[model samples]
Target chain A: MIATKRRLPLPLAALSTGFVLLWVFVAAFPFIWTVWGSFKVEQDFFSRDSWWFAIEGTRTIAQTGSAFTGDGYYGAWVLRDFFSSVVNTVIVTVSVVVVSLTFGTLGGYALARSGYRYTFWLLMLALVFRAMPHITLVSGYLLPFFEMNIWGYMPTAIIVLVAINQPFTLWMLHSFFLSIPKDLDESAMVDGCSRFQAFRLVVIPVMWPGVITTGLFSFLLAYNDFAVTAMLLSQPNQTMVPKIASFLGTIQQEGNVMFAVAAVVSATAPLFVLVLFFQRQIVSGLTAGAVKG
Target chain B: MPHRAFFAFIMPSLVAMLLFIALPIISVAVQSFYVQHERVVTEVETCTPFAGCTKETRVDAEATEKLRNEEPLGRFNGFGTYLDRNHLAVSEIGAILSDNAGFKDAAARIYNLPFYRALAFTLTYTFVVTPFAMLLGFCIALGVDAIPPFYKGPVIFFSLLPMIVTPLVGALIVYWMASSQGILGATLQTLLNDPTLSLKSSAAMTWITLLVYGIWHNAPFSFVVFYAGLQTVPHDTLESAMIDGANRWERIRFVVIPHLMPLATFVGLVQLMDNFRVFEPIVGFSAEANATSLSWSIFNDLRGQVDQLFGSAAATSMLTIVGVIILLSPVLVRTWRDFNRR
Candidate 1:
């Protein structure tokens, strides 16, 4: 539709094509290179002989008569007990999504259904909190958590993550709830249903897409978090990002840089899958505010 | 909605926000007024006169313990920590002004103070990255829109990868490629014909690399938004402009841009907020030596060895919160007006 219905442009089209290709390369090359490099021995990957070290098999691999190696993934996942980190990440992410979505949906529905002035102020409050740097809360939580003897546990971290995720969750879901028509629930209420019953019977069935999208974001916030998890959870409870960071600090000296590379790819794999599966919802969720505003 | 139903619905979020968000903010503000201190113990040692000896004083463990136990929150300084060198650096500013230095010299002196230096980089990164990302995104959206529909989906999926990936991971992917031993860094070193030349070797180079990364990571968000905006660009208006003999460039300049302004503003506001809180890239790139942000400074203060320095971190957090509030006030005002109008 935006082709202008003209066929006279040659150089411009070429330039556009080049730009798009350049962007694609810029976006895709790093993942491809990293994933490729993670499968090779460090000596061969960083051999300095050619830029094609990743594409072409290394001398060590040829010597061993194997095209690829799992040393990096093995070192990171098995030796480092990355399984615990994965378990911790799942526990925290699931808890955060459930709690954040529950509160967010309830509050968002309230805000959307009500016509009072206070709802506006409440949303404004959420916007302010959403914009504030979350690290600010870490300083506040540290002293209290320390005194309470709960500083380095998973539950405290989960609660904090849920709190931190609330503002954005409420904002996104509030807009989503607003997009749902109130008439459905009102008619349900007219049919002898209470407000809660109406919400359960009428609004929730249609609100799954919004909930899923918001839940996706909440999961990202909890799963991909480094600052909160790193600060709140001590040695035993560290998640993947912080574990990878610790690996980066120590493994480079031990000649195990590939472990970190493999871990990074592992950390990124789920998000990649998330994007693949939910590309439409993610895009719409992102543009929902902009388009509506 | 009835008051009871509304209260029931909003209560959980209100309580969560009150406990986590509101309470912490208040606690941080209060904590900023107090500083943590270690009690120094003093001990006196007596010498015998039979041989030549000297009297010595050592730390008194019991006294120090007693002192710390009495006041666990440390000493109340009432904003002194905020004015200290790690934060506002009030006295240091006085010293710099007294020297009558040049602008660059004064700036360097101020940059020596950690807080101002972080603010400088944060502002520069935010301002520089936001506009450039928007421009690049607009250009890409236009380019993609002009292309045939068959190629758009894959191109978009590839483009979204950068923005959708976990930020630190995205940054690490780029950081690995840009490291001294990696492909780009090696190529740049060879291109310069200096074996020791690396992107991480200099502050200027690292700053540029980070800015490039910022643009590369975030421009796709703008692209997606602008692409969506392009879909709603009013077809009749485009056709009318075309019939009026407006060329492609003129149509874009006069019609398409004006149409996408709101989305651009939305993207700009969101980008500014995101960029101001830049922390992960610094960690991913190990660029702390060359750059620090307010958020990073807070992390640093809290990670101190002997003491957590909660006061200083709180001060920085409050400053960061203030900065965010200031930057977002315009958007808040716009939203308020829109809400009232509705």
Candidate 2:
């Protein structure tokens, strides 16, 4: 039993459905194609004879004696030492997330609770900071980092990433803190708790949802970063994104483009899982700022 | 909160930002006024038994290192780097104009300069992609809203993948697919009836490819925002509009658009900021020969083959910061007014 009043006309319904399906195909097809292609040899994946060869893996069978092979993965992970880069990425992203959240929460809470005019200016400054091209900042850091003899360490990169993550983190957490009823903390203060104690005891418990959302963004920033990691990191301390980039340079020269392909798929897999699990939080975090504005 | 407590609470974050963010701008500003010290060359007369004595000039590496150690900021060059041929090229543009070249010729000459070329592409990409992405996103939001609720979740999850993926990786995926041997590229070549046709083969095709990539990467963000905004459209207002003899289109035009206007501004602002700094796509696409952005120019300078051009990179960085401020002025002014009103 369809509600006739609310239903779209048949033609319009068909058009809209077709359009939505087209968009989905456009969005998801490339990743799916690449993932499937990662299993095949380069000739099969980028088949010039016919596109069906990509799907059918004709050359893949001839080259490896099987339609699917782990040669690319083996080359990237073992011979190229992508595992060390993965380890570095873990250390950097984890440290950045933890430090950014710790600092962001305190700063964001203070900004939300404060009544002074300077708070507004602080936020405005952050807006300007947020808009500055990140490479510009990297340019600034290059000389000083070299002079200080700390140019290529994981800790230096982590601290720099945490700093870069602050403006967005502060703005997001500030808005989220605003949404929390002020009375929850005010009431605690009336019972003789200091401001810090009140925040620690009362606000902390209820802050996880917002903190978790902001933390997801921080993790993404640190993980997806290319400029800082590529420029600031030593060769041995490179992260996954930059490692994939470096793979393009060296592996492509070795005539093993499939290694880069496999690494790309490997890098994307975690993000796929991330979106699958935290889709709700990522969406909310994105809309949180927009909806409030 | 008390002043002391507020300061104490914000100290760590504020210090991090000031030290890392604020200080870098100052450092860039200072570095822009100085060029790297030229190699200290010394003239020496050498006497040999087999040949007549000849004067030779050689770089005094030890002395140069000493000078560098004493003053690592390099030799001060005032605004020389900013006005150099690689950058603003004030005198070169003046020469072109004075020579009475045709407007198109003059424009092309100016665009040939590295800074202007990057700036032109950056502004064009930002302006073109932002609106198109927003419109496409709004349409997609409407389409999703019209669909059955059960399918919306999966649609959103897929829609988000383009944006959730790293910009570099996402661009690489498109780059690989559009390579001459790949499926889409091969299909296009056949359809166009030209085996020579490749997206990366020409400047125009490369620009179009990057623009399409930009739109695809950005539309999902605006889509998610607009979809969320669409959910909050008032049911009562829509019902009243319908009862007042307004058709579906009119009802949407009159009520829904007004409600979504603020969210549109939010999306536009964020997109403008992000798009202005487009760098990774150029790297991923390996389209630096065809296209570059302001960020890419800075990266290029910093990663020079022989020695890093710190002064040149810093000058470009300072200019980029100024550009960012100019882009953000309107929003900042509005926010300032709102704050004062409050």
Among all candidates shown, the one with the greatest DockQ: 1
TM-score of candidate 2's chain B against its reference? 0.96
lDDT of 1 at B316: 97
What does the i-RMS of model 2 come to?
A: 1.8
TM-score of 1: 0.97
True contacts kept of 2: 0.78
Candidate 2: clashing pairs of residues? none
lDDT at A112 for candidate 1? 86
- Over 4 Å off, model 1: A2-8, A62-64, B50-55, B62-66
lDDT of each: 0.86, 0.93
Name the lDDT of candidate 1. Answer: 0.86
- Position B116, candidate 2: lDDT: 96
Q: By lDDT, who's the top model here?
A: 2
TM-scores computed on chain B for all candidates: 0.94, 0.96
